[model samples]
Target: MITISGLTKVYESRGRQVTALDGVDLHVREGEVFGVIGQSGAGKSSLIRCVNLLERPTSGTVVVDGVDLTALAGKGRRAGKDLRRARSSIGMVFQHFNLLSSRTVQDNIELPLEILGVSGAERSRRALELLDLVGLADKAKAYPGQLSGGQKQRVGIARALAGEPKVLLSDEATSALDPETTRSILQLLRDLNRQLGLTVLLITHEMDVVKTICDSAALMEKGRVVETGTVGELLATPGSRLATELFPVGGAATGPDRTVIDVTFHGETATQPVISQLSRTYNIDISILGAAMDTVGGRQIGRMRIELPGRYEENVVPVGFLREQGLQIEIVEPQDEARGAAEGEQAEARDARQDESQIDKQDAAPAATAPALVKDGAR
Candidate 1:
């Protein structure tokens, strides 16, 4: 429902040009929660702002539902009437619940309807409907300060939906909330997306938010999109940094004699006891160093780091067996302790052999130093 092509935004500070979004190309499909993740200065906020023309791009287009917002108002600093009308269909939820402290919950939700010239009765009806939709129907009279952070965000979400938007733009809406509250808010977003068939574009530095609710995600770094794809596609893609970050597996230290491998599983493979099968098939004992398992969008996803008894070369067939079972595997370097143990064993074997050689030499020395048995003719 949203298409951003070659979107670039730049600002001036101290007479120097600062680029916030550098040629970002992103697409959000209908009824899907698409997440943009990055660090503090990775241009996540800039990308979201440009989507709604909150920050006009220096170049490129922002098209929502076949309407190009950038083309609505000619390169101007302020939004015109046409741009404002277009923005009404695109709702936004801010990081801080930017509610009017003076207004009650119902008035906060009705503010958008009032701006659109909605009648008092119609506004009241829509406000209550949205309040119920966001699970805050009972808080219509509650003030912002009277509610918890989660409750206030619910009001923010309810207010954003007052205009019946087709697309929802969320800018760190759950950043300030606690972990338990964050999950509830994300679940609410997911439910709203499914119920209303709304397309959502959310930006956050938190990976948990994306993992829990988003079907597709993109990673931004230094004002550029580094990677973008469906969650399953990224997990299957080799060397996918987003996938690795989403499902982090601790690395096990290895040596020349030992093997460390990471195994990834999704779908049907996740239901199988692959580790036990490998142990039974290869007859090699395996040690699990670290693992992460998650149920995302009702699909089981897992990553595990395991250590095998032998080196990669010796366990090549076993690794191949894991691949045959439809698991992604990555071999990691051995740690120092394993390498040191191999060296120590080699040194001890060498010393034992040298000691045996010395004993044999001493036996010969006794024969040589003592009177040897002479031949009979010689005696």
Candidate 2:
């Protein structure tokens, strides 16, 4: 488990102070895969680096497994012996597979154990065990250049686990891989989390990563966390930004007299014919503008945008009826100028963030792009 409070990191570039983290407060429960998502320059990388004291926070406390790392880190850039010992319990996987090119895969994994003063025989045994654990037992003698991107990452993961860390910190571990490779890597992480009871905290710009493996997630923007919750809780929340982004249903009121609303389905309701039931009970025709269904945390979840044949006031009874059946509903078109303008502004902001994310991806080295969908899990 990890807990960060009032965490702020500031950088001085060219006589100007730029804040990377702005009083961030986050908590990751034991044995849970937590994700932090945001566009470029959103402080996601900074926050993760701070977790391992790779980047010392300007001010705040970081507690891991009840040990206050900030306190152990005396007032300096260099880590003290206590802090170094604490860091050995936290494993980090980088976006770029940071491995020693000169060393073989087995040697790379043993490097950490060597640093920890592990004996030569024990290190060899442990390295082979880890290589097997990551499904790379046969490639232990291969060099980094000899392996594929996914294989290299597996080696990186095996190296990180050499110390048998209780927590795993992933910094865009799958960003550079192809879609199929990314999915494989995510599945590996999930398997490790369950098999080893590891607490994973990963930061990525890709929503598909969160949808696939994250048990809980936090949305960061402009150096602050805007939203944080369990995937199911976010899905069930009315007007949830995370929920809307995960299952984007687009459409607006087609006519002035119609009321457009979004309905969320989860748990029992996701499998039920709730929409048809509502239509038949009310004896009114409904128009579905958009819809999306996915699974999150082993549960089916869905969202739909529907148009009713009346104003918001006239549909109050029918909306209440839906709510009574345990559905989360939000009136997208309320026929109020101020509310509509606010919604429009929110939509614009979302589009701008998405565009920025796409630009960031494009600027990186070319790789196969994947659609943002939860293949084996839900968001």
Candidate 3:
């Protein structure tokens, strides 16, 4: 388990001060895949860097398993043996697989155990075991240049595990991979977390990666934690502007005669018939313009764009009904003003119809008098 409290980091450049982390507090339980997400300059990098003492925090503390790493600062040379021992229990995989190109896969993995002064026979055995764990047993003799992006990452993971660390820090581990490869690597990380009971801290800008492996996540913005919650809770509400990055639906509205709504389906609502039933019960015409659905922790989360053929006010009934059914609904506003102007045109057309009806009645009166006059003349 890892705990970060009041973590703050500031940098000075060209007479300007930039805060990388601002009093950030995070608690990651043992065996949990915790994701830290944010855009560029969100202090995600700074926060995690402070975890293993990679970047010393300007304030606050980084505690791992009851040991405050910040307190151990500057003991690197004097308390050399202790520093090595503490770091041995924490494994790190970087964004760029920093493997020694000159060393073979086996040597790269064995490098950590070698540093830990593990026995020769034990290092060889552990390196092979790690290679198997990462599904690269066949590439044990290959060099970094010989492997693909995913393989090099696997090698990085295996090398990190050589010390048999209880905590694994992944720094954009899959960002460089293709979508498919990213998925595979994330799955592998999840499997490793469960299999090894490893506490993982994964830092990335990709919310999809967090949803895949993290049970809980914290959204960082401008070096501040804007949102933090279980994946389920975040998906259910997604209230924080930072949270909506995971589920985004953008579209232009047609007219005020129609209401455009962005609906997110998660958990039970994903499997429910809320959308269709709401439309049918209201007897409102519903048109779907766009949709996206994907699996997170084996649960399906979908976003649908619906256009209701009626006034926006009229669709409020159905929207309330949907929320009652446990759907997160947000009304989508059109970029164009025509979406609201259509109602005015409808009113004008109604007035025109009424005017036509009145003209018919007046014309009937004239025709009736004309018929009588004609009869009188004939008589």
Candidate 4:
């Protein structure tokens, strides 16, 4: 298992300190494909860099398999044998297929073993076996320049595996490829994850990457992890900006009397025809707005948006019951009237909180023979 706690990174640029990671806490289980996803500059690159000690964190602890890696080399940047040993067990791949254009595929794949000083004959034999494993035995003699993008990635994956690594770090290994090539590469990663029982950590900006390959993932925004959940759990979470971004199906404008809802079901619940149950149980009509069925990590998952008649409060019981049935239920905004009421309620709540805060501050005023507010603001 990999455990990270209070991970932080800060850099001085133009005489100002900028924090790239803000106390990130995460756990990646052994033998599982985990993903870190975000828009550009989300510090995904920084987090993964910290994992391999490619970029040592400014603060926090990285414990892998019960070893505190930050203490490597007794606090100096020079890693002792412990750090080198740990690093040899962790392999990394890149967005670009960082292959030597001049070398044959077999030679490229054998580079890591060679670096470890394996015997020449053993390196060649092991390289062939890896080629066969990746279904690239036919391309053993081909140079990277002669292969397609997907084939080159296969080589990259093969080379990263040569050290018999327990962990595989894939950093945007598919974003540069076309869709079909990306799909093939993802399948290969999944197969390798299963075959080697390799704990894989991949970072990507595309949501589809997480939906396709990762069993569990975290969504990052501006260097902060906004949310982390199983892909299915994320899809089922209501008003999830990440899920909505992942599955952006079309929903049209409807009449004021019509209500819209987004529903999701997983595993057995997906096949239960719960909408029909809701209809039969409540005698209310439902119009299927849009839906899609897809599997993630081989788990059946489905999502749909439906239009329900009348106001939200009128169908509250039926909706609440659906929630109890373990279906993911999201009420799409009602018409302007309902929207206005919701906004009004939220504004009133905000006003109430502000009023309470003001009252509390007033109550505290007499007790303050106090420090100046400006200078003591942080307190």
Candidate that scores best on TM-score = 2
lDDT of 3 at 106: 97
Q: How do the residues 1-379 of candidate 2 rate in per-residue lDDT, one tens digit apiece?
A: 8999999999999999999999999999999999999999999999999999999999998999999999998877788899999999999999999999999999999999998899999999999999999999999899999999999999999999999999999999999999999989999999999999999999999988888889899999999999999998898787778888888886677778888889999899999988898899999999998899988767788899899998888999999999999999988845443455578799899999999997786567344433332232244
Model 4 lDDT per residue over 146-173, tens place? 9999999989998989888888999999
For residues 1-379, could you state the per-residue lDDT of candidate 1 as single tens digits? 9999999999999999999999999988988999999999999999999999988899999999989999996766889999999999999999999999999999999998998999999999999998888888899998998999999999999998889999999999999999999999999999999999999999999989888999999999989999999998888787688987999766445445778888889999999999999898778788897899998776899888899987778988999999999998887665534554577689899999999997786577655554543343257
TM-score of each: 0.85, 0.88, 0.80, 0.83
All candidates: CA RMSD (Å): 19.1, 7.2, 18.9, 14.3
lDDT of 3 by residue, 281-337 (tens): 988778886787878777888888788887778667788998888888777666433
Q: Give the runs in model 4 whose Cα sits over 4 Å from its true position.
A: 73-79, 249-253, 334-379
**Weakest ten-residue segment in model 4 by summed lDDT:** 366-375
Off by more than 4 A, model 1: 333-379
Question: Against the hidden true structure, what lDDT does model 1 obtain?
Answer: 0.89
Candidates sorted on lDDT, descending: 2, 1, 4, 3
Estimate every model's Cα lDDT from 0 to 1. Answer: 0.89, 0.91, 0.83, 0.85
The model with the greater lDDT, 1 or 2, is 2
Candidate 2 lDDT at 54 equals: 94
Q: Over 4 Å off in model 2, which ranges?
A: 334-379
Name the TM-score of candidate 4: 0.83
